[model samples]
Target: MEKQELFKIGDVAKMFHISVGSLRHYEKFGLLKPEYTDQETGYRYYSTRQFECLNTIRYLRVLDMPLDQIAEFLRNRDVKKIQEMLQQQKKRVVMKQNELQIIEKKIENRLQQLQDTLSSELDTVRIIQTGPRRITWIRNKLRPKSYLDLETSIRQLEKQQENTVVFPGKVGIGITKERLLKKQYETYDIVFLVLDQEDNYNGIVEELPNETSVAIRFCGSHADAPVYYAKLANFILAHKLTITGFSKEITMIDYGITNDITKFVTEIQIPVAAI
Candidate 1:
């Protein structure tokens, strides 16, 4: 009988660029077993015969296949099984790619919003024209007097959304036209998430058409909203503008983005038309 060449566990790990513990894990998982083990030293050794199996394991792992699935495939070892697994993994990869793209888009939008808010003239109200916006909203008399109350409302909105992705910098609280006219700034009638035109939504959606709006950006959170809302009201009154729609008060920067209170920026936009 010819002597078969064998590599020690450490040498095999180094060759494969994997940790030695990974080999032990594979053995524990019953995925792969060493070709030989010294009884006295309890050292694991692998021969060239195991190289193909290890290579297959490494390849499947790179495809993000679970160890159990890889083990099943290795045990079955058929062309049809591998083809089906590859198809299933390909679908998973495509799904992940789509999810990652959505995440990337959200990051870009958030960064752009932060830049816009930082450069904006704080506390200065202006009349600006805005295009249509789509929003998913939950109508409730939510007076977020404290941070805890605000979080509770947000969680409620999230629950209503089911699996929809809520993008930051796009959340807003609404005050009805009547409430605004009555100078009711403490109570919010609706909590809404602004959605991109391409966003997949499962809740009630409304499209707000293009209109001129009274807008102001200020350094504040929900607690500081009343002051800014009053400023918008004053601006609208001075400009002889009639409030035409619900207020869109979004906190552009908050604890979610940073903990510094001084850096907080909130914007209030209310659709208005010249009276």
Candidate 2:
């Protein structure tokens, strides 16, 4: 009788391009066992017959199948079981693709916003027509004397939201129509998260109708907002426009985004109408 050839553990691992530790792990999980173990040396060896099982293990692992599931299938595999597993994994892959698509869109929007902010002409007030915008907001007396106060207010607003995933560049502070008329620029009456058209939120959502607005982008945050508010007020007065709604003040770039104070940019948009 002819003796069959067997490869050592290291050689088998090298053939499969996997670490020897991985083969040991598969043995520990009872997923695969070596063809033979030398009693005196306790060294492992694999016969060529075991290669088919190792190849199947590698194939399923590439599909991200859990080790326990792979072991179960290997124990009792058939065409029907493989077909079912493939369908389930396909569903998981599709779901992951959808999640990636949403993430891609958010990255694209953030990139555009940063580019627009970098190119914006600071301190120049302009009257522009804006489309209707939707926001999920919380009404609070947020006169931020410090960064902590502002952070607390944002946390409170997030708590009120059903969807707690707040994205950057979507948050804004608003001054009431009366507050703007009174020149109370430092005090904000509401904090809001502007919603994309696809966003679904179960909270205090409001739609600000399409209207003309006096807008100005500046190199500052809420702390530097009072000066820009004064500028917008002057622009509105000079143009004979009346303040019609809450002022939307959004920080395009701020400490939350970057450490550099020079990169900070904030924009204030006040809805208006011709008198």
Candidate 3:
């Protein structure tokens, strides 16, 4: 009788430079099945043909494919099916890549702020008589994490605003009347949407009455916000403007979750009278 050629688990592991224990675990997980088991010693023997299968399994697993999916692919060995599954994985990876890119850009922005613009100018303030106009906005719970998730929400709000209101500006901005308060784990309610009140054409905004607001540009880290707020309070006092309604901040720039330091840029709005 001719002896059949076979490779022991250790030999295969050595060939692949993987530990024997890792191979045993993979077998236990149904990722690799031995060609035959010795009855007396209960030793597992793999066919040389299974080398490619093991390599493929490890590759797919590295791609973060679930164990069940990996088993299915190994069993079926269908190229088209594998390609389809890989395509779905690619999309998930791409979404993650976009998130990472946003984070990196934000880090760069913060670094620039830290080096050049954080505390050079004091008593820096601006006042603009924002004309009455129409805008479509979305109000929601906002916080540090919310900015990280801004793209999806911004896309949703933009679609909704375009569907519901006649907006002229090509830009989308978040506007709200909340007092930019920082409460740990507190729900931040702010509006995210399209603000185009200059154009006469309006579908939803035209329904509201005209009101005035005092606006200030805040270009600093979060620590600088209180100072800006104090300045806003001072501006109101100096101008003798009447405080009528809730003050708001229109988010023109967003540094989404690159880091958790003192870096945030927003346009602070204070509602005031013409006194």
Q: Could you tally the backbone clashes for each prediction?
A: 0, 0, 3
Per-residue lDDT for 1-275 in model 2, tens only? 12248889999999999999999999999988998988899889898989999999999989988899899899999999999888888899899898788778778888998898899999899888988888877788877643456677677667745554466678888999999999989889988888776566666778878888999999877888898899999988998999999998888887678889898888999999989
Ranking by lDDT: 2, 1, 3
lDDT of 3 by residue, 184-220 (tens): 2223354433333322323344232455666665654
TM-score of 2: 0.87
Residue-by-residue lDDT tens digits, candidate 1, 1-275: 12258889999999999999999999999988988898899988998889999999999999999999999998899999999999999999999999899778877877888888889898888888998888878887887754456666667667745565655577788899999999999999988888876577776778878888888888888878998888888888887889998898888887778889898888888999888
Most accurate candidate by TM-score: 1
Q: Which stretches of candidate 2 lie over 4 Å from their true place?
A: 1-5, 35-44, 145-147, 160-164
Q: What is the Cα root-mean-square deviation between model 1 and the actual structure?
A: 2.4
Worst 10 residues of 1 by lDDT: 159-168
Model 3 misplacement above 4 A:
1-14, 17-22, 34-47, 98-232, 239-275
Ten residues in a row with the worst lDDT in model 3? 166-175
TM-score per candidate: 0.90, 0.87, 0.43
Extract clashing residue pairs from model 1: none
